[model samples]
Target: MRIERKERADATILHADLDSFYASVEQRDNPALRGLPVIVGGGVVLAASYEAKAFGVRTPMPGREARALCPRAVVVRPRFEAYVEASNAVFDIFRDTSPIVEGISVDEAFLDVGGLARISGSPVEIATRLRARVAAEVGLPITVGIARTKFLAKVASAVGKPDGLLEVVAGTELDFLHPLPVRRLWGVGAITEAKLADAGISTVGDLSRFGEHGLCSLLGGGVGRHLYALSMARDPRRVETGRRRRSIGSQRALGRRPKSDADIEATLVAIVDRLGKRLRTAERVCRTVVLRLRFDDFGRATRSRSFLESTDRTDMIMAVARGLLDDAMPLIRDRGCTLIGLSLTNLDDHDSIQLTLPFEADHGAELDIAMDQLRDRFGRDAVTRAVLVGRHHGDDAPMLPD
Candidate 1:
């Protein structure tokens, strides 16, 4: 039997990404900050304006280093509420533009406009309108890339950044992607790029010529096959909406200074507290507690413990997370800790748990509910743990919906 493969005949996928999202929002709200180099967050650079980036400033860089790089840059604390409101407004516009919209993060999304050609005109027209709408309505600049495949669309958006629009027309995907450096590929990070460079493969065209067999021999089979497929423009992914997350997590950067055990434990408590509240709000329970640690040398380690049953109780999850942290303390002390993070994985809906008669009332559960109510009525600062009193926990970074 002979089978014919079917593919979309036109470029209909759009990768819309906001330019320097946090910094852009800061610039949009404050007229005085406009056209100036801006850096968000004081301890660690969360986001940098295009002007600051021109001077080699980047996110996650130490504030001290960034200041040295761009002396006149204006540093500001992140206003998460404003960023969230802006993200919601932009997503609303995305939904209005296309019924099939997949949100990647707070600042990026993939929109599929495959069947709207007759009514909405071409993909280029739709992308133009989307960019204009975001600038006029949200008062923020956004760049959009239109292509037949999601990978190519994302690549195009990256190539045409800082409020630009680019289109990779059908039948010209290879022409557009091959000349770019291998680093432009989605999964090629610093280590991978170094490895590719060692092999004398610098561009996508070089990678394609290396062939899948050669790549599999050079790299591992899974990664080699993935990159080879991308080099050939063979992505078949569809834009998905209403997707659920498998894990919920948060982290805090503790800077380069040495952190005492007490300080690290306190930070863990703060992260667990926030994650617990988020879990209950989303009506999800998790069965695994994972602790992530980064050392001053940039090496990373992870520790995790699974519970017998899924739980949304703050105390139970905290107990497990603390245990994992305790186990990792030796490594942390040896390497000198730089960051700590926690993740609740193996998630399931709260409704899925079977109800059982309790021998005794769950005081911890009651306390969690009470604290959540108090924070809801008042603000997040209304309720704080005794250990967290007078301690600066830093701002919570915004995340995509769990």
Candidate 2:
């Protein structure tokens, strides 16, 4: 059954994305790094400036390989605080432009400017002003893509990267989208792109011609239908604001170095500690613990466990996380894990948890609250788990606010 989608007549949705966000932040703060190849993070390439990207430097690549690719690149450790501050400033501009804003990450957002045609001018005009404001106010390069649909807007922004603005007018979206490579479509990652390439479907037009049934036969139902819809420029989603995050999590990239079981456990402990603090601070509780591993070969594995009841206690969440990690250890050992991450999912407001018996005391919860208070009062380093005392957990990757 094909459901008809009526897209907006005007291209009002804007996708504003900061170029090479972390690396750009570094470059903006240091005049010497501007226009020069810059890389953020010494162990892993968190971000690379366009100058470095021209030399094939990409995120998650090991520092050694990145240096080999761009020897002149100035590598700097990630300062997440600075990135967060810059993100806040950019988002402030987003809100000032439009009340309907959907933040995709710390560096990108979707905004609906449909109703501001009179007061703010056309979408293109608003985008130009937005770009100017970000440069004048925050001193960062942001690309804005305006389209009738969120998907197309995001794609336009990607095409008009490194400080540019593009608008895909209504009735001409197909003309703009069809000539692009299949990889430009959402959900078409490297593996999917390879699969499509094997079948000689290289462009969006080719995929659209292949039809949904053919794609389903090749790529399974969900992904195939999705790609076909996108190839036809059929996205109907609108910019949504005030959406609370469904999950709170953190991950640490461990470079291509062999780690012992103890080392892995310590990393896990540190991650859980940070997540627990964040969850409690947000007044949320999670019922599921998920462990994500990226192997040295770049293959990924995920193992998750859900509890009957949700809690914000660090010890309880860590216990489940440890169990999931334990179950995945054999696979990690075989694959040579290079990264470890955790997500606390199935979240709800703290008030949703049923009241405990009046006399039933949760010492673990008390401890968690106490520790969070100390961390809040002093600093994140004020309290630490014994397991993470002397271990280097690596930088906490910047993320959207929970």
Candidate 3:
């Protein structure tokens, strides 16, 4: 499951992402929630209605903080089954409109309508109709981006958010993209933006003027070339649908409170266990590890590492996840924790048993495998992490944004 980066910018594609998907769904279902700030998550903010967003409440924010921002906001727990049903309905619309639809997440997808121009109307028309239909039938706000390429379409959707529709005309892509901040570029993260800002390149226009050669020297050969081209509207990438997603990940809110080291470790192991089982079931091997942590103070951190070989072993993933957690111990201790997650990438189709290191043989791999099998045959609750058994004692602890 390789997610190929957009190599060119001429591929006609549209990326449609729901606005505050979970929270919007809840609000839509509950009449009393209309026009009120709504936050979704058990202990943390999984999604926030646009009304909450105006108050600076955001996903992954601690529930306490979200409440502080919008004192009158109503909080709701996530209804995953309801979300799945809504997502299926949305996908059904995508299928009827276009045959090439690529789902990026539960809330977002890319639609290829190059061949549907005559039957489905223009891309802009299709996007408008789709957005209205989603609101009418699914009772959710959806933002759409219609562009000549996937990257630009995704960027457009991001820019026109909270139930917006934006189109980057084929020839005016550069004009539309240049004024935005450098962070709007897909790969330009905090660190990269800092580097660009250090070089007096603050916007896409500035980066474009910096030229590919200069950017290559600043951002390495590969990134510099790709970004400069994107800035200049020279992308030629295609819309790839049905590409198997490389990873599946989940996180839980621990509530906005300090967690003991043991509690954190237990949570990490549980997440790794869940993700590892999914990887194994997919018959996929992942060579990269990703860790995400959210702190009580509303700060966020992420770390990733690449492995020489791919593996789906719980022990292996957990061991690496622990190492990553250890690396972030100082920050976690200082800020306290709210949420943690794990994801594996760089996936391959191979499902063969990988040889274990001599030291790893003692890492409880056998027991974990046995438990996964038994749980698969019996039920998820048949075997539970011992730490969770007595967690009621710590129930009074701070809550993370659920």
- Candidate number achieving the greatest TM-score relative to the actual structure: 1
Ranking by lDDT: 1, 2, 3
Instruction: Name the regions of candidate 2 deviating beyond 4 angstroms.
Output: 1-7, 358-360, 398-402
Give the residue spans of candidate 3 off by over 4 A: 1-11, 42-44, 62-64, 189-203, 213-223, 286-335, 350-379, 390-402
Task: State the lDDT of candidate 2 residue by residue for 1-402, as single tens digits.
Answer: 122224558898999999999999998999999899999887678899999999999988988899999999899988888988999999999999988888889999999888788899999999999999999999999999999999999999999997999999889999999999998998999999999999999999999999999999999999999999999999877677888788977877777778899888998998899899889889999999989898877889999999888888898898999999999999888888777889998899999998768686558888888898898899888888788887776586733444
lDDT of 3 by residue, 35-123 (tens): 99888875778888889999999766678878998998888877776887998899888877777788777788888877666687778
> TM per model?
0.95, 0.94, 0.77
**Model 3 lDDT, full chain set:** 0.80
- The local lDDT score (0 to 100) that residue 206 gets in candidate 3 is 99
Q: Is candidate 1 or candidate 3 better by lDDT?
A: 1
Clashing pairs in 1: none
lDDT of each model, Cα atoms only? Answer: 0.91, 0.89, 0.80
Q: Sort the predicted structures by TM-score, highest score first.
A: 1, 2, 3
Clash count for each candidate, listed in order shown:
0, 0, 20
Lowest-lDDT window of 10 residues in candidate 1?
1-10
- Give the root-mean-square deviation of each candidate in angstroms: 3.2, 3.1, 5.3
